[model samples]
Target: MNAVTRLLRDLVAIPSVNPRLLGPDVETPAEEPVAEYLSVLAKKHGLDVSRQAVLPGRRNLLVRLKPSGKVKKRILLAPHMDVVPADDSQFKPSISNGRLYGRGACDTKGCIAAYFHALCQIAKYKQRLQHTEIIFLGLIDEEHLQSGSRAYARNGPKADLAIVGEPTRLQIITAHKGDFWWQLKVVGKAAHGATPHLGKSAVHQMARTVEILLTEYNDSLKEKQHPLLGSPTINIGVIQGGTQPNIVPDTCSIDIDRRTLPGETENTVRKEILDVLKPHGLKPDFLDLRGVPCDALETNPALPLVQRFMKVARRRRTLGADFFTDASPLASAGIPAILYGPGDIAQAHTSEEWIDLTQLEQATEVVKRFLQEVES
Candidate 1:
């Protein structure tokens, strides 16, 4: 097996499931094992390594390749370390049909392996990198709260450009949608089952609120569309109301997952919802489920570095991703970021997650070449 494929297999074999995905009493190392493994590997290669404490036991690992000469430009290679909850069998990685199968195989671990392989290859000619410094950041808690990236953004150095890695089929992604979660609750007086007219039904009012959001509010969102990301989207994932069939529901609530495009803010979105609901005399309580909104990423494709990277990847046009990534937080911190990596996102978070070996090798080579070019 090639070096990149071997590294990916080893990584998959180590279970680094996000702690939030597990039960409270469940004993798991979370991302510690993977962070230690990468730390040892970095030290073996004589690279600078450090850790950024994110949570009580979780930390983000940093492996750096400093230039021999003065540092003029800084490039960050960021790939998340945490994976979604998986069965024990999924942790034992296996290779078959030119694919590596395991948890986080395509979701992100492939990106971590490919980026590390490329960094190691570039370390051979350190003298050539006179002015550019490359850093490999293994972020934690990306599957849950994204605390790792948030901590790095607040404490990490300012980077000229950041290459956020994910399963993108090796495409250069310049834009992606953001996620905003909210819960709307409608309140009403409880009434007896027999006398339904005595007290108002909150569930019935919530039904109207949901209808407006699904129809009129949804249609309005379609009118404002982003070229690459398309239109914003809203999904009523959950609804809770009433205790029993007879008792009138005093309170009804719905959890909403709104995918926001560029230029869309929490205030604007809330205002839009209010505008639609107020006309119908419906004023539900609004609560921000996600304390901090995940903003959309829209890096200028015209930047010199971006253009050069696209040229290296041999892509004439940039693409957009519907899902959010660590790129947004870094970008919001003033660093231009983009997503690129091997494998398909369809295989992410699946029962049988796997990555294509051919794409993995290609991604390593592409990243290596890009780093060399940036150095020169």
Candidate 2:
């Protein structure tokens, strides 16, 4: 097996599932093993590596390559290391029909392996005056609130250009949707179900509220459209109320997922939702919002580096991605970033996640070629 294939197999064998997505007791040394493995390889190749403590135990691994001459261009390569929880049996790697299958096979161990392979080659044997300094970061907590990226952006070194790895099938993605999470709780009086008129029903109130949001709010969102990303979306993901059927529900709660466009902010979108609900006299009682919102990505496609990378990859068409990635935090920090990597986004997080070998090879070549063209 080649280097990329071998690296991906090893990555799949290690379980680095995100702890935030599972029960409290269910925790693995998320990304520690992967970072160690990469560190060993970096040392073996005579490259410098550093680790930053992101959470208590979780860490972000970084590799910086200094230019032979004065640095003229700065580039960042960031790929997340966490994956959603999966069965232990799914961690076993399998190859069938040129596709490697396992947990995180597509949702980014493939990209991580590919990036490592290309970086190793670039570090040891690039035969030209290097005017570019490249920094590769393997981040933590991308499957949840993207705390890793946020932390890195706040404290890490800045770059002129960055590529946040994702399963984009080697496409150059310049724009994508953002994510906003809100937890809403409604309170009412409780009494006997038989004589429901004695007490107000929180379940009833929630039903009416959800109905209006589904019809009116969803319809109104269509008018606010983006050329490549299309329209923002709302998903009422979770709803819970009442303990028993005999008693009227005293409280009802729901978790709202709002997919924002490039132009929207947390405050502006929340205000719009409030405007819709104000007429109905329904306001949030205990709404818990995410501390940081993942803003939509919209890097100027006209950037010279972007245009040059596209030419190097021989890709003429640029499109928007539907999924949020680490690019959000990096972009929000003023780094001109885009998402690009192997494997289809559809295969990510699936039960039988896999990546085609051909695509992996192509993606590795693309990374190498793009790095080689970083001239002063």
Candidate 3:
């Protein structure tokens, strides 16, 4: 097996499941194990390694490859360390049909292995990078609140460019949709079940509200389109109402997942929804479910470095993603960030998550070539 593949297997073996996805009584390992392993590996290679404290027990690991001369530009290669919770057996990586199977095999551990392997290869060759400095950043909590990336953006040095890793099938993604979550609650008076007219039904009102939003409101969003990201989208992911079949439901609530495009804000989205329900006299209370804002990413494809990287990857056109990533947070902090990596996003977080070995090797070579050429 190639060095990068071996590294991916090692990373997958270590349980780095995010704590937020676990039950209160469940005892599972977090990102610390992966961070420590990366730290040790970086040190062994004679690289400058450091850790930034994110949460109490978790940290973001950074390994640096400084230039031979004065540094004029900084390039960040970042991949998240945390993974969604999975069965214990999924942590044990397996190989089948030229693919590696395990949790986080495609979601991001593959990117980590590819990027770090490229950095190590460059270091081993003693490439004379006179004006460019490369950093490999292993971020934590990307699957949850994205606190690690947010903290780094607030305190970390601003780089000229950041390549945030995700499974994009090696496509150079310059734009992606953002994620916003909120709950809409409708209240009514409760009374005897037999006398239905005596009590107002919150569930009945909420049903009408959901219908309009899904039909009329969703259709309206199609008009507000972005060239690269297409258009904003919405989904009623969850709903809760009533206690028993006979009892009148006093309160009904629904959790909404709004995929916002560039230039869309929380205020505007809320206002639009309210406007739709206003004519019908449906004034449901809105509750913000997401504590932090996850804005959309739209990196300028015209940037010289981005253009060069695209050329290195042999891509003639830019692409966009519907899912959100850590790139948006870093970009919001004034860094130009884009997503690029091996594997397909379809395989991420699946029961049989796996990445093609061929794509893994190709991604490693592409990153290495980009680093080698960026020195000029």
lDDT by residue for model 2 (106-204), tens? 889888888888888887785443777887899999998788888888888888888888989889999999988888778889999898889888888
Name the runs in model 1 displaced over 4 angstroms: none
| Model 3 clashing residue pairs (backbone) | none
Q: Candidate 3 regions off by >4 Å?
A: 194-198, 244-247
The estimated TM-scores of all candidates read 0.98, 0.94, 0.95
Could you tell me the C-alpha RMSD of candidate 3 in Å?
1.6
User: In order, what lDDT does every prediction score?
Assistant: 0.92, 0.87, 0.92
Best by TM-score: 1
For candidate 1, give the lDDT.
0.92
Clashing pairs in 2: none
State in Å the error of residue 342, model 1: 0.4
When 1 and 2 are scored with lDDT, the better candidate is: 1
RMSD (Cα, Å) for all candidates, in order, is 1.2, 1.9, 1.6
Report the lDDT tens digits of candidate 1 across residue range 29-89.
Answer: 8899998998898888888999999898889999999988898999999999999998999
